[model samples]
Target: MFTFEAEFFPDLTKTSVSEFCGEELSVLLHTLRRNGQLIEQLWNLVEQNGAIKLYCIAPEEDALEPRHFNRYGLEALSAVLQKSVRPPVFRVIGKTVGLSDACACENSEYYVLFSNFAAEYSPVSCGDCNLPVPLYKLPGENEDEFYALRQWQGEYKACDSLFVLSGVGEKFGYREISEVDSSLTRDGCDVCREMSQKCNRPFYYFLHRHISPLETCPRCGQEWGLDEKLHGFYAFKCDHCRLLSDSP
Candidate 1:
């Protein structure tokens, strides 16, 4: 048997409680835990309104579902609600600027963190070459900019970061005009060419001003740039022996 602690705003109206049961509630809880101001406000709200007893239960171990894995267990329910519900209950909560809305706004501000994580960690491969491609959505690009890029490219691919893509382009000689002209292609890689054509600039132009420091091999002290290949896995190829190792 397992027991979990559940907490809720005591003065929540029935409607608010119902709304909180799904995605809004999960987003709110995550925001509250992350934002210090919201946590203080939550404590103050509880102190003024008094605590409400919702329910208590201990379920048998065999009866537990996958959703129960999280300490709060609300996230699993929230995921289901987000799919079925339209516009999300949290949008309404945001408009009200109430206790819940404050937390939601904070959560919205940090949503890009998740986007960055997805860009870096998600499995991505080039459609034409079938090789793993490093793609990134640069920070400060809003949803509108993302959509505009997709529209310009005439196809949609799930890359958010431009820096990683630029790095890949530089390594493959795709962004160099001389190489493109010699090869009779605008870019070396199909993916790089598509992005360069859409942006009206060479892919290498997106490379960060400061290059990443070359990693030094522990065994031989050889320096090399990290490269991604074959389904987005990373490997460092030693400059000395051309040996490939997973770690530098």
Candidate 2:
């Protein structure tokens, strides 16, 4: 992920910056995020020296380009930026310190939508490189956005955060650990099925287990342990269930 800073200097000729910069700007930022144009919503919104500056993460250097935005996002951005003195000046500040190599699997044999509390970017990953697969790469009905995938990622992250927090989050912990049946597992499996059907490739739902290693698949009660760990992480994978899990 790349970090960028956008400075929106107030138009001195105008009495004040339009009200769009407040909540409307935030909505626009998230709209871009859901469209896969930005990695996350504006991380920082600061007002200083009569200017509003925003910081955010992007999947690529050209992620913010107009070509990447959905119709709604593009429109919202134009409406908000017009309120600035000039166009919002964008500059790359830095890259994510520990971002993995981006997925290069144009025709990956399979894909996995996997994310944890620590991961705030796209959950879909190429099975081959174990790197994030940009949401836009996957075929979707939406012209330029994978809003459904983004919504799933948000729900998954919320469940993961609760699981990580522990205590009084038994339901969340079980959801993460279970290979099937849990609401999270069901939702993730639905996403996997949809993607796989659309792409004509296997898409697996990664289930994280915090307990001891098991010799058999939890869902099917069959031998599913891989002879060699996949990506040195997934200890088990059930083709029938379209599920993968890491053993502690």
* Number of the top-ranking candidate, with lDDT as the measure: 2
Q: Considering summed lDDT, which 10 consecutive residues are worst modelled in model 2? A: 14-23
Per-model C-alpha RMSD: 18.2, 2.8
Across residues 142-181, which tens digit of lDDT does each residue of candidate 1 receive?
2232333323222112222332366554443322221213
Across 95-178, the per-residue lDDT of candidate 2 in tens digits comes to 867665467566888899888777767788888888887665666456535656666778777777787887688566656545
The 10 consecutive residues of candidate 1 with the worst lDDT sum are 106-115
Name the TM-score of candidate 1: 0.17
Per-candidate TM-scores read: 0.17, 0.84
- Residue 81 lDDT (model 1): 46
